[model samples]
Target: MSLRGKIGAGAIALASTPLILFLGTWEGTGQNIVYGDKLARGLPTVCKGLTEHTSPYPLVIGDFWSDARCAEVESLVIRKGQLALADCLTNQQIGQNTFDALSSHAHNVGTSNTCASRAVGLINAGHLAEGCKALAWAPNGTTPVWAYVTDAAGQKHFVPGLHSRRRAEARLCIQ
Candidate 1:
């Protein structure tokens, strides 16, 4: 093979290596750890105070489910699901922080709802900054509500915890 051809092949191999490693064992682990820490230890938005507040999702927060193991498992599952949804919805490549932030938002809001969200649409359209900002909006009737929730009467309520969560996510997205 020509020297130039060999160099090109070597470059291709090197490029693919990180991706291979990332997609292999490295996948889902980072986001899981991040979200786990954020949720379990209490983010500025969710799970604050020592008083055992209710979780955003009723299904995840069952009776007597306020243990460390439960928090870890819930965070892991949420991050994994959100990351998968972000992968499916995004058209452009995003950084780890951005992806993780989106995962967090998606975790709070249902992945299916996120898929239909204006945030996802903006991301797919390459309006990433706008999309990240859009994540701050709370979905009506969704579990966890992250930053905002709508009552049965459709009144939108601002949740400090959810707002804090959204700020963190937006900050991560830009970084």
Candidate 2:
């Protein structure tokens, strides 16, 4: 082989190494869930804030989280949520907007629960709009749900902020 050919081959191999490593890490870590930048940042902050301040939610009374710690937590939460959403879907190849939106929903709703959730069912059934709608209002049958629950008197207490969340999820799903 020519010297130029050898150099070109070496360069290609070197360039491919990072790509290969990144793909491996992404797959192994389940970080392949494509999150739009904005949603990635917004979901965690929204969730954390709601957790800290929302009523009927266990009141967390301290500004204990440093910026870095908060960011770390958010990153972890989003990644886990994305993985959960991806796992729930029989079709993993989805758009970035859908991925971000579902990840946000799952982060709030719990991944395993979301996997078996009405939202996922709707999505898998090809009812995208209805699926997004379900994400907003439907009850997740999976164990370990959030603070929203029913009382002995048969009154239900749903999360107040979830309406907005549903809208957001719907928007992303449609996009």
Candidate 3:
């Protein structure tokens, strides 16, 4: 099925195959183990980036999740993120690629922030390409915004992995 078809079916089915694959590629399937997120130190994350915020229960170090469990949680998380983002999007006619890119961004950042981002505002204003570019850079187009991670001391620093991911997301959005 095409990505659009999958997305339509995802409304009832929870998650689409392509969306799952895209998130898995970025989030990484850390199967059977729970580990602290270096970026958000002390937070236990597992199974494709499920943290206590996204999980039904608290996650601790040494926690384990079977492959099936991981798949289930990942799908749930993706679906939830998609639904939350959908509420913020005024343009219902957006293409599948744009939707996927926005959903992926919402999954990584929070839906609240993604909804309020300049990218979404630009997209709503019908500036599709500019919106895509805004995913990585600020409106000025030079300074990076979403590519940084905040440390416990409240210092934000550039994260290479996040920068690469945002670039990939922008590419997907413009495609």
Q: Residue by residue across 8-127, what tens digits does model 1's lDDT show? A: 454212112332232223123222122222333333222211112223443222224334644454455543464456445645455555555665555556567777777778877888
Say which prediction, candidate 2 or candidate 3, comes out ahead on TM-score.
3
Give the backbone clash total of model 2. Answer: 0
Collision pairs in model 3: none
Measured against the true structure, the TM-scores of the candidates, in listed sequence, are 0.52, 0.54, 0.88
- In TM-score terms, which candidate is top? 3
For candidate 2, write residues 1-175 as lDDT tens digits.
3222333454212112332233233222323222222222322222243332121323333324444544454455454445445556654334455555665555555667777877778877777766766666544433222335455566666544445555656666667
lDDT of 1: 0.49
How do the candidates rank by TM-score, highest first? Answer: 3, 2, 1
- List clashing residue pairs in candidate 1: 45-161, 146-162, 147-162
Q: What is the C-alpha lDDT profile of model 3 across 102-125, one tens digit per residue?
A: 888888888899999999999988
How many residue pairs clash in all the candidates, one count each? 3, 0, 0
- State each model's CA lDDT, in order: 0.49, 0.47, 0.81
